[model samples]
Target: MTTLKALKGQHHVSAITANAMKNYEFYTKILGLRLVKKTVNQDDTSVYHLFFADERGNPGTDLTFFEIPRAGHTYYGSNSVSTTSLRVPKDASLEYWKNRFNEFEIEHDEISIVSGRATLAFRDFEGQRLALVSDENNVGVAGGKPWDKSPVALEHAIVGLGPVTLTVQNISALSSVLKDIMGYREKGKYEAEGHEVVVFETGEGGTGAEVHVVARPDLPAERPGRGSVHHVAFRVENQEELIKWANYLKELRIPNSGFVERYYFKSLYFREPNGILFELATDGPGFEGDEPFETLGENLSLPLYFEAQRKEIEAKLKPLDTREGGKN
Candidate 1:
């Protein structure tokens, strides 16, 4: 078995949202993540593509979305990303978030211990599920660079994305991809919402290193739309490593999008046996590829191919007001 030693942690989790402004406010104003990229989806030039992350838009911190109002509500079931978990400091930070969520009238669950870590689960404005998992070992926050201008105090600001839950009908097949191809190890298991959940961990077993799988044999397959996760990306070192991963996926006979250039990073996409989309993305040519780090997401950016239609694209996109507390 060829081991994916160059594979790092998660790159980003991409999902769909109906309202662009609502999604923007929730992630930026409410959650305090930096809007690292304001661009249009490469495939769909009209809809907005937004990326949020820690201060620098690091690989593991990214959570991206595509605004598609006409896509309608997501069908909940197997073969989908059920929830995304963000990392925060343990104890005090978790308390701070709970209070903050309360102050903002955000609905969230009481802190529950999952795999020995304190977790507070919540939903976004569009009903996209999310969770904040405390780094019980207190190591993940030490290196995190939070957005200084965020309303949330720097200390309590979310660090980055951690484990993301994938609901699958065929857990055994997906588990093989995580273990044999993606360099993840089975760490622990627990029951959640009546489903048996198995935990997997990658590099060093801390924040940004976990992926949870929930087996949902009784549920039907999901329909992708608003609130539906489009794909989950795993990080590779660079283009070289990305190509290696693409080759590996080919050898495994997994159908994949080979070596796609996404401007900011190169990507190779594939689906596991259960039809959940996954991507292996490189870390470099980061979010700052087009704009300087200081001005990231400050204005609209178009890919080279779409640059010709910038005027038309901008005209079609509904204005997004990211100003403090601005509502749509």
Candidate 2:
């Protein structure tokens, strides 16, 4: 059975060029997320793997990165997949980001909300689309940390993904898949001209996050390339729940991308009925196992797999100073 006791909701990582330093500044100084891990890609030494998260760089709080220089700007069309929708606390902190965007000259727009919550939309240094949201509950970055000069008594940070959108040529086809096959319920419209935004909060949630899906009927097929979202992960309670999801996908004859070992997590990937890439990940032994909560994101840490080759990899990877992803 694919059921387990708990499932870590997400482990967000970026796919960008080799500008490691700029990312450091934006994530730490500007956005306020602590730099959890500094390491190079195990498979590709020339590239790096940077992790950012809450006080401890926990799985759900994490927004990781991959530096891939040669990758070009992603094309935004109908077929293009929806990547990440980040949630922020939604108060004066939003003003912080707004002014920060102005100060750093980061391009962004305020997202419209009906009866749900307030949201701000922006992109990462890598051009992957991202969102900042404020919802009913104020649960986020560990309290007592100073964000900006203000004593941000709450966690004003990237909590996790709000939702991933999928644009299908045939709306009805995707709709059926989401309903009959996937256990997703329709949330509501988040866009005026685009496809409807569908959502599904975790029935067995460990935190207070909601998944949103904004369908784009007017777009063309998306090509997977650099700076684009690799995939979106969904959370299950445990291994038993994971296998149950696998079996459910099997029942629909969906192809499993295979189980991937993310070190801190184990995940199974497959496209849902609407063609949105879905990952089922376990929650446990989070980022803390690699670094202490006190010193997370301050330095680089590598798994045993890449520890020996740090020197050689460091030479190939370029400094983020060369390519600044953030405006400021």
Residue 53 C-alpha lDDT in model 1? 89
List TM-score per model, in order: 0.94, 0.77
What lDDT tens digits, residue by residue, belong to model 2 across residues 72-139?
66776554455555556555557767777777777788755532656677876666676676644544
Kindly report which residue stretches of model 1 are placed more than 4 angstroms away from their true locations once superposed. Answer: 1-4, 138-143, 322-328
Model 2 clash number: 33
Candidate 1 per-residue C-alpha lDDT over 247-313 given as tens digits, one digit per residue, 9 for 90 to 100 = 8878888889999989888999989999998988888888776888777887898778778889899
Query: Candidate 2's C-alpha lDDT?
Result: 0.56
Q: Which stretches of candidate 2 lie over 4 Å from their true place?
A: 1-18, 42-45, 137-158, 171-182, 204-209, 224-226, 239-252, 273-276, 306-315, 319-328
User: Pick by TM-score: which candidate is best?
Assistant: 1
Worst-scoring 10-residue span by lDDT in model 1:
319-328
For each candidate, what is the lDDT? 0.83, 0.56
